[model samples]
Target: MKRLKTLASAVVAGTLALALAACGGNGATTETTDEGSSTAEAATGSTYKIGVLQLTEHAALDASNEGFVAALDDAGIDYEIDQQNAQNDQSACQTIASKLVNDGDDLILTIGTPAAQAVASATSDIPIIGTAITDFAESGLVADNEAPGGNVTGSSDLTPVADQIDLLQQLVPDAKTVGLLYCTAESNSEVQIAMAEEALDEAGIAHERYTVSSSNEIQQVVESMVGKVDAVYAPTDNTIAAGMATVSMVANENDLPVIVGCDTMVEDGGLASYSINYYDLGYKAGEMAVEILTEGADPAEMPIEYLAAEDCQLIANQATADEVGIDISGLEDAEIV
Candidate 1:
């Protein structure tokens, strides 16, 4: 474990923060009437000190942060945001979460489950809007999905695991056994894995788990399942998503069909998937933050938001298809990546 940063050194740590300021410039406007006194126009809106805690640097997580910022800007909320990335380090997440809480930010937006959990543990008084988290209840971030009894509530990137697995089966019909790949440390991935196990059981398909604790083990774990499982089903997991190049290289070399959970992963070199628009999910979370900051809405009463089935799209990678010898022509409405 890495050493954690103390709050006494917050300024030094703040300097280490990305310090991304997302707001319009020059809100000050001067207006003069018939009198000699000149009055300045009111500022566009309330300026807020916002803190963003992202788990890691990946396409999905990056999109979520961008979408959240876009929503805040569209709502006319002037905000100075401190962006901190854990870089998949647990100690870094804790250290940054503590600094953000100590910074006296008006609101905190966490992009991934680990980041949300760390910030939620740091302070409950500061309203937290989390995006890219799968199950709030399972993660202990909220009491219920409909009525979050606590301050933590936001959007859930809970992709349809069953439907995604079904896509894998459709792409590889003769595959007898499938391997579920993910990081065991992520609670969100655990929830999806359980659902996937149920889906596989219902379909009477044999399935096995290929779990890894960190990105360092992704290559070895994926390589272990080469011949044992005919197909691989990986969720929108952070660790696995970040190391997709390794996973694809190993799986593709063995002529294994790897089905991913998000469209961004397909672009990263997976076979096919039911894509979740993480940007829209983060935008939804940002709208919730707007309500809390400007509209005075309570996250405790806000229900967790999700993308409907109609919102999810089917996607496949033509390059991976040629490499793994799979046919995506049978999949309807699947956008080629």
Candidate 2:
């Protein structure tokens, strides 16, 4: 009986030793599999998310947004876009900025100055790209116009103020005084106003400023400037652009002609406008954003670029010009859309 028990114990020990050796070999194989899985994951890069914040819904702003998206599509990158419209509300703009920051976006594209300011205030880490902004210096996004030394770099939609003044003079040769209409709250409008004032001085033309805080004040402002100035110049102010119809109605009724900073304004019934295409500016901004994402370019390093095209179209409302008894002779050479 002792000899049979000894043989069974020997067999059990051998089986235990073989099982331990098998587990040791499997453990090494498992570690190698894990390392291979990690390598594969590192090779397949993760997708990125982009947030776009626009101040208001207007033709020009909408076109900018469209151009931005189109550029992104042209670059075949895996990206998601979260778009928010502030509806011309500053407070809403702040809220949208906060929400986008919290949502973990890789980059944020702000359409207008107000939206850019809100996004810049919201996050310092996330890259901020601005478009359709007139003056980065005036918007407080940068220290100077030439070098925007910060995390924010973008495209400027600034119309040449001196050229605009000259265009107005060409259209209205006999005009002695011009009235500048804009929004006081907007830094962009303020910048344009300053430039316009300087240009008017250089042209030897007398000019006055008519500033409004909101759309509600436009009628009163226009009425006040009617008999005071010969012609009115409206910059690309958001408030004025949104309430252009009212300004046009009041100006047309008062037999006044208005020269605007954008072509869309002319389409909305203004007498004429000379400005860059907003969509092209936005598309350029999108190209910059992609560079920041894929090429690993620093936003600060990318200087704020202006649209290359200085081409401005002279869109005239023939009916309105005729009604006001204003003669536009060289309009045939101008690109009338």
Candidate 3:
């Protein structure tokens, strides 16, 4: 078995206690839930339950959640979506994941790596669909990306980190040193950060690392990077994205252009981004989930999908460009948002 995440495994035992308590209060079991789903399929088809455990609230993640629901709606898949947000807390993901499992959801859609890990540890029998995750294999949510070989599978939101860094250089030509701001608690952030560093180093640019363990320290941590770096590069991180307003305020006020990994961050007040569409990413995941439910598709054979490179848009915050004194008029290819 793959090693469960430290925080997620720490709460797995407690999840069991809740699991036991749930059985005494209800007449349902996992087997019965499946039988009921079959019976519902023969009748009104409204008994299907889907658990949505989101890591946090951010425009990108929210768009993904919306896209997921939209897909189910368009497909006429009537399901009782139990939406749950962990509020960027790993422990909370563990608890919610356990509850979803104990509640015997037909499937679980985890919006981030932490939520995915928590649910993956909670139950291997229930199909888990993950989105907004950088790497399923790297995060240990699956045995392989191309072939999941297990119950977990979904689209990977591995943004073009290297290309984003290159665009950062083009956007901030005078930027000699860049500050990499991210949350250490987010594994996906670390992956993007490392890729960003490598891309920056290849271009012979100096960079610094600025990490915050939680959202409470975001403003302070971002504030500390003012004079130290010429620009800030924040990856598609849940904690940092949730606190983007503070980040933009600190960096934009200082005339430090922030190049982010998600387009939603640019809309949230960053300078620019070359990122994938989270809505499309989640919609694809929803289709995969639909195939699993309707066609009896096996998650094990499903390869992780991703948006095409052409789908990544070059987005710039026009208001931020005006504030940062960078004339983006020359970059006509970028869509000014």
lDDT of 3 by residue, 1-337 (tens): 1111222221121111111000001111121112123432556555578989877777998899888877776676657778888776666777778899999989999888878888998998999999988777777777877799999999878877777877887888889999999877776677777777777988999999998877789899988998999999998888788889999998899999999988989998999988789999999999999888877899999988888777878889999999988877766577898
lDDT of 2 by residue, 1-337 (tens): 0011121222122211110000000000000000111222245564667888888877888888888877776776666788888877777777888989999888999988888988898988899999988767656786654566777988888776556677778778888999999887777777677777776888899998898887889999999997899999998888888888898889988889888888788778788766678888889999998888877888777777776433445566665676566776675555454
Candidate 1 residue-wise lDDT at 192: 72
lDDT of each: 0.79, 0.74, 0.79
Each prediction's number of clashing residue pairs: 0, 0, 0
- Higher TM-score: candidate 2 or 3? 3
Candidate 1 lDDT (Cα, 0 to 1): 0.79
Per-candidate TM-scores read 0.87, 0.84, 0.86
Stretches off by above 4 angstroms in model 2 are: 1-45
Query: Can you tell me which runs of candidate 3 are displaced by over 4 Å?
Result: 1-46
Clashing pairs in 2: none
Off by over 4 Å in 1: 1-45
Alpha carbon deviation, residue 172, candidate 3 (Å): 1.1
**How do all the candidates rank in terms of lDDT, highest first?**
1, 3, 2
Total clashing pairs in model 3:
0
